[model samples]
Target: MIQQLLINEIDLHVQAILQESGVERPSTLKILTEHPAHLEHGDYSSNIAMQLAKIVRRAPLQIAQDLQARMEKNGRVQGLFRKVEAVQPGFLNFYLAWDTWAQRAEQAAQSLGGIGKNTKVLIEHTSINPNKAAHVGHLRNSCIGDSLSRMLAHAGYEVEVHNYIDDLGNQLADTVVGILHTRTEESFDRFGDFCWETYAKINQAYKSQPELAEQRAVVLHALESGKSNLAWMGNLVAERIVREQLEEMKQFGIQYDVLVWESSIVNAGFWDTTFELLSQTDMFHKVADGKLAGCWVLKNREDEAVAELDNAEHQGDKVLVRSNGILTYTAKDIAYHLWKFGLLSNDFVYKKWGAGLWSTSSQGSKKKIGHADMVINVIDHRQQYPQEMVKLALQVLGYEEAASQLKHVSYGVVSLSPDTAAGLGIAISDGKSSYAMSGRQGIGIKVADLLDHMESVIEAKRSKKTGISSRTIAAASIRYYLLKYQLQTEVILDLEQATEVTGNTGVYLLYAYSRANSILDKAKKDARVLHLEPDFNVSLLEEQEYPLLRHIAYWPETLAAATQQLAPSLICHYAFELAALFNHFYSACPVLKGSESSIRHRLWITQIYKQTLQQALELLGMPTPNRL
Candidate 1:
C-alpha cells in the first residue's frame, strides 16, 4: 500500500537522522500518517518531527526540515513524492507525484492478488437457541458475522462459518415443556412462530406456578441423557426450529459450513473428556459447603479476589456441574471450544446436513472438522462475562495459544426506533433513545416479518419499468442496515430510514452502481467508443477525478484496516465514501459525451468504480443488482 511505503520511507530517514546526530534511537518509533484537512497541506502528513523533538533536543521545525531534506535527497523516494516539505508546528508533509500515483492507482485498481491467502479462519455466529424464531437482534449477529466471513474470504482466507446450536440448554428445555403441555392445533406453515409463542407462554406460566419450573429439570435430564422419548421430541423440536432459522438467514445470503449441536458434544463424550481434563486441574472443584454444596464449580481467581476485597456475602464462582450431576452451559461451551481447538481427546461423528454443509452426530459418518487457527464467536455484549470465562478456561487448561486466538466479536443489541415501535403497535416512553426487543415478551420483529415488510415497501416504490425484484432489493437493504454501525453502538431499526433510496442506505449504493452501468451501457452502444482504445492521458483528469481514483486505489488498505481492527463498519464507511465520490464525479465530469480521450478515461474510471463498489457490497454480503 502507498501508506505503508510512505511509512517505511519516513522510518528510514528518521533512523539515519538519529544515528547521524549521535542520539540513541528509541526501541519503538510510531510513525503516524493522516490525510490533511485540505489538499494544499499535502496528500499525507506525519507528526514524527514533533514526536522526536524532545529526544533530539532541537526545535520541531528544525527536525522537520532535516527529515524533509534527507527524504528529498534519498533516490528511492524520487517517484513516490513530488515534494517533501516541512509544514508549520513541525509536521512533515509529503505530496504524491500525481503521475506516479495515477499509474500505481490504475495498476492497483486492475490487480486482484496479494492479500490474505491460504489462511484458515473459523467464525461461529447466529448460535441462537433453537427454541424461538430469529428476531431482529439475531439478524444483527448473523449479518455482522457473515460480512466478516465474506471480507476474510475475499482477502483470501479459507473461511469456515459455523452456527453452534445450543439444543440442550434451558431455553430449549422450556420449549420442550411448552410443546408437551400445549395441545393446540398445528400450523405447519408457522410452526416456528408457534413454538415462539409457546415458549413465551411457558415462561409466563412458570411465573404464576412455581412447580411448572421443575419440568425444565426433567426435560434437561432427558436431553442430556439422550435416546429417551422426551429427548427425541426435544431433538425433533430443535432441529425443526434450526431449519426455520436457517431459512430466514438464507434470505440475507447467510450460509454455514457446519452446525455444531451442544447435545452432540455430550453424546459423543467430548464433555466427559473435558470434565476429566478439568478434574485434573484446580480449575474445577467441589463446593463442600454452603448453598453450592456438592456442586463442581469453576473457580475464577479474579472473582475470588473481588469477593475477598469487597467482603461480599455471595461468592462469584461459576457452577460447572450442579449437585444433581447436570452440567452447566459453560461446561458444554468449554468442551465445544476445546473441540474447536482440537484440545480434547474425543471428537464427534459427522453427517452431511446439506450441500457443502456438515453437522455433528453421535452415530454417523466421521469427518475431521474444527481445529481452526483462529475462532471468532459472534455473540452479544451481554455475554461478555461468560465469554471471558471461556477464554480463561482455555488458559487454565494450558492452551494459552488457543485462548489468545479465541475472539468474542460482541456487539450491542438492536432496538426499535420510537417511530418503528409505534408502527409495530408497541408502547414506548417519550424520552427514550430506543426500545429494546424482548423475545420472552414476544416484542421483537421476526426476521421473516421484517423481510416481508421491507419487500412490500420496496415493491411499492419500484417503477413498473424496473427489472430487479423487490425481494432482492429488500435483502440488500436489510443486510446493509444491520451492518452499518459501530460494534458498540446500539442500532435503532427505522424502516423509513433503512429503505430510503437516496441516502447512505444500501439502496443508494445499488442505485449508484446502476447509474454507472447505465453510462457504460450507453457508451457500448456507440460505434466510435465501442471499437476505440485511445491513448490514456492522466493529465486530462480534473480535481474531482483524483479523489475518486485515490479512494479506489486505497481499497486494499481499507480491507486490511477492517480486517486488523475486526470492524466491518470500516468497510461500510469506505463504501459510502466511494459511492459519494463516484456520484460527485458523475455529476461534474461528463463520460459518454466528452471528447474521445476524456470519454475513454472516464469510462475506465467508471469501470473501476463499479468493480470497487461490487467488491465492497459482496464483502458486506449484499448482492450487486445489475439495475435498480
Candidate 2:
C-alpha cells in the first residue's frame, strides 16, 4: 500500500517536471532504494539523478537539488513530502507525510477480501512408512507440511493435504515376521505398540539369525501366494499400526484428505498395470547377472551408482522383478506414485473409509477421484535419488504432463542430537533425545508421546492465565508450538525451550495477540466502534505505533514468499518478528490510558495488531490464547 502511494507520487512529479521544461522525454520515473536505511532517508529515493547528470554533463548533486526544487515549486508533491532535501552525494530524500506510515495498518486491514483471496494449493507431507510408528523425525515432516498447507489456505488458497502411506515394504515383511513368530505376551500388552516393538526386534534379528530371515521370506512367499491365514494376519497388523499413527498425528492437527496406502495399490493390481505399461514402452530390461537373471531391471543411473557406494554390498542394481517373481519395494512404489500422478492406466475402487468423520478439506465428504492436476510427494531427502528415478521413469513412459507436475518436496533429515545417525537406536550420548525412524529397536519416540509431552507443558502454562478456560488455551498452544520452525532445518526440540510461554517461540507470539485482544475487549466496553476506513487519519499515529503497523504491512509479502519458496519456515520467522515488534510497541505505548478520542484510536490500532497476529498464528497452525 505504501509502495503504491510512492509510485503514484513519483509519476505525478515526473509528469509535472516534463510539462514545465517542455521536454518530450517519453520515459517512466522509477523509485530505487538499496535498503531500509535508504527508505528512512527518503519516502522514495532515486539514483537516476546520477545517470541523468552523466548524460547532461552536470554535477549529480546540483541536478538532484534542482529537481527537488522544481518538483516542490510546481506543487506536484505538495502535501506528500513533509520536506524534500538533497543530502550530500546527490541523494534526494523525501520525509513522507508521517501520517502515510501510520495509515498503512488500517489501510491494509481494510483491503477487500483482506485475508486470503480464493487460491488453492495441495500439500503432501509426512508420508512415513506405515510399518513403523511416527517419530520425532516424522514430527518435522508433518509440522512443515501442515504449516505450509494452512498458510497457503489462509492466504486464500484452496489447499488440499495428502499423506501417502507406504504400507507395503520390506518393513511390512518384517512386521509380518514379528506378528507370526517374534511377538511376546509383554509386547502384545498394547495392540499397535506390540507390533511396533516386535517389528524393530524382528528387523535386528534378521541380521544374526538366518532362520529368522528365512521365516521372513516364507511369510513373503505366503503373502504373494494369497494364503488366507497369512494374508489376514498381515492385513490386521498393518491396519492396527496405521490407525495408531493416524490417531497420534491427529492430536497435532496433521491430517490428510485420503490415506493413499501402498497395500491398496497392491489390491487394485496397480503394479501389474504399471509393469505392462513399462514393458510396452520398453522401459524395463531383463537383467543378465549371477543372482538377478530372469529378473526385470532398470539400469542404474550414474547418480544412483554413487548413492549405493555407502550401502555397496546390499544396494546395487535393483531388481524390480525378482527371479522368484515377487515385485520389489521400488517397483511397488513406482506403481503407486504413477497412480498418484494419474500416469498409471489403472485405478482403485476407493471405498469411503469415513473421510468426512474428521476434518473438512478439499476432498470434503466425497469419494476419491482418479486424477489431480498436480502431485506433491513429501519424503525425506535420503530417498531423493529414488524419487528422481520415479520422475524419470514416468517421463520415459510418455506421461510427460503427469511427470512435470510430480513434485518431490524432499526435506533434509532431522538429526537433533550430536550422536544422531539415521534410523532409531540408542545414541550412547544423549540416549535418544529426538525420535529416530527405525522399527527394529522400538527406540524412536512415538507421535503420541511427543503430543502428550507438549500438551502437558501447554496445560501447565494455560493454568497460569487469568480466567481463560483450560480447553481453549490448551487447544491454542498445541497448534502454536507445533509449527514454530521451518521444515528443512534440524530442530533440537529441547522440551524445556519449546515449552516456554515467552521468548522467540509460538507461545510468545500467541501471548502478544491474546494480550492485544484482551486489551481491546476491555476498550470495546467504552470506546466508539471504529472501523478501518480508507480515510483513517494516519498522521494521528505516534512513534510507538509505527513498528506495529510496519509488521502488519508485511502479510501479502509473507504469503507470496511462503508459497513461492515452498517453505513454511518463512511464515514462522515472520510471525516471531511480528510478535517481537508488537511486544516492543506494547511495552512502550499507552493505548488504554490516553485521552478520550486519542485513546479510542490507539485501541483501534491495538485491534489491528490483535487481528493480524491472530490470522498469522492461525496460518502457522498455532493457537491464539485469550490470556497469558
Candidate 3:
C-alpha cells in the first residue's frame, strides 16, 4: 500500500510536468518504483526519467530534475517523503519521513482486500486417485494448493476448492483386480493402506502377466455399470480411501470444499452433454479409417503436449472414447473441466460430506458452486499435454473467455533426497543424488509416515514439560519446507532438514514469533511499562526499528505480487526475511528493559511484528502455536 502511494504521486506529477511542457507522455510509460539496495540511497527509487527520455526529447537527467522539483512542492508527496532527489544516470529516489514509516508500522495488521473483486476462483488440487494412500509427492501438491487457496482468500477472492476423485479410472480397476488375485491374510486398518500395497503389486505384475492385465479392461467395463458387484465394491473402496486421504491431509491443514467423484460426472450424463457440444466442432470427431479407426478423437494442439503423444497431427491423436465404447481418462477429464467452468449443460448433485464439506452424490440437492471466473488445476508438470488439450477443447468450441481463464498450475513432481529415499527403503541406484516418487512401484514415502517421522524428531528434542504439541510443530515445518521452494522446481524433501530448529526453517521462524510474543507479554505485565502505551517521538526509533517497519510496510505489495504470479514461495521468502529482521531488532533493542521513551516504540514494534508474523503463518497454511 505504501509503495503504490509513491508511484501514484510520482506518476501524477510527472504527467503534469509533461502536460505543461506539451510533451506527449508515452502511452506505455510506466513508473517502476522499487526498494533501494542501500537505505542511505532512498526508501524507494525509480527510473521513470530514463523510460521517458526518448519520448520527451530531452536528456534523462534534465527530465528527472524537472520531476523532482515538482514532487518537492506537492503537499501529498512532501508529507510522505522527507526528500525527493534526482540522482546521476537519470534516477529518481524517494526518502520517506520517519513519521510516514511509523504510520505504516501502525497499519501492520492491514490486509490486501478487493484484489479479486467478486471474481470467483475454483482451485482443483490434491486430486489423487482413491486407489492408494497419499504419498509425499501428493503432499507437495496439497501443500501448494492449500497455500494458494489461503493466499487467494486473504486477498479477498471467493475461492472454492475441489478434490476430483478419479473413482472410475484404471487405477481403481487395478486395485479391484489386485484385491481378487492377491492372496493374503494381512488385513489393513486403513483401506487406503491396503490398496496402496495392492495397487503397486498389481502394476508390477502387469509387465509379466498380460492375462491379468486384460482383467483391468473387464473391470473397467464392469465399473461403467452402476449395479455390478465389482462396481459396488469399487464405490465402497473409493469412498473409504478418499476419507483416509482427506484425514491425512487434515493433519497438515489441507481440506477441500467439494469432493467431486468422476463417477458422478460420467454417470450423471455430464459427459453426454459435453460430447454433444464437442461433436458440433471439427476438433472432435470419429476417425473413419486409420490406426485409431472407430475411436473418437480430440485434435491435439501443435504447440502443446505433443511429446506425451508420440503420434502427432492425425496419427492416433488423443482418443476420447475407444471402439468398445469405453471412455478414456482425457475424455472424462474434458467433461469434468467443462462442468468446472459451467460450460456443460449438466450439473452434479451436491450433498454435505464429512466435516461439513460438500461432495457430488448420485442423489442430492444442488448447490451454487460452479460458474467460476477462473479454474486452476494443480497437476504434475508431466500432465502439461492433457491440460493444454483441455484448453484447446475450450477454444475450438468457441468459449474464448473460459478458455483464457483456464489455468494449469503445473509443478515439478516431488522426489526424495538420497538419504530420505534410503530411509524410505527405496533402493538408490545409478549413483543418483535423488529419486523421483513413483506410486505405481510403491517407491515413495507415505504422507502419514513422513509426518510421524518429523513429529518424532521434534518430540525427542522438546522438553517433556512443555505444553505445545510436537505434531503441530512438525506440520508447520513440513508445510514451510514444501512452500519455501519455487513452484516449478522439483523438491528433494529431507525430513531432518525440514524439522531442524535453526537456519531458514519454519521452526526457527516460529521461535522468532514466540520470542516476540514473550517480550510483549512481559511488557504488558510490568507496572513500569503497563500503563504507558506505544507512544513516542519518531526520533526515539532505533537503527533496526525503521527497517523493521519498512519491511512490514511492503507486505501488501508482497501478497499482491505473489497472488499475481501464482507463487507461494514468495510468501515464505517474506516470512523468513521478516523473522530475521525482527530477531535482529530484538537483539539490538531491548523492549521492556530499555529507557522508557525508547521502550514504548520497541514494544509497539514487537507487538506489530508478532501480529504480522501470525498473518504470514496463516497465509502459508501453517499453524501459529502458542510456543514452539
Give each model a TM-score.
0.94, 0.78, 0.94
Model 3 over residues 78-166: C-alpha lDDT tens digits? Answer: 38778888998899988778676666565633546767779999999999988999888898999999999998887788999999998
| Alpha-carbon runs more than 4 Å astray in model 2 | 1-39, 42-121, 183-190, 222-227, 280-284, 289-295, 299-319, 355-370, 399-401, 416-437, 461-482, 526-536
| Tens digit of per-residue lDDT, candidate 1, span 1-628 | 7777788888998888788889998877698788786778887889999999988888999999988887877843747688888978999887777667656654553333346565578999999999988898899999999998987776677788999999889999999998877556756467789988888888888888889899999999898888699999999999999999998899899999999998788887877888889889876788787767788877887765212223232346777787888887788888889888888878888888888889998778877688787889989998887788788889988999999989999899999899888877787767687888876776778888888988998888877537578888888888888888999888988877866766788888888888888888887788878864533467797998878876886786787788777889999999999999999999999887768888888887898788888888888988777677
Please report how far candidate 2 places residue 163 from its true position, in Å. Answer: 2.1
Measured over all alpha carbons after superposition, the RMSD of each candidate to the real structure, in angstroms, is 2.6, 6.2, 2.5
Q: What is the model-wide C-alpha lDDT for candidate 2? A: 0.63
The TM-score of candidate 2 is: 0.78
lDDT of each: 0.83, 0.63, 0.83
Residue 321 of candidate 2: its Cα lDDT? 80
State the lDDT of candidate 2 residue by residue for 179-202, as single tens digits. 666647573434666667778778
Clashes of 1: 0
Off by over 4 Å in 1: 75-78, 106-118, 183-188, 303-315, 464-466, 534-536
TM-score of 1: 0.94
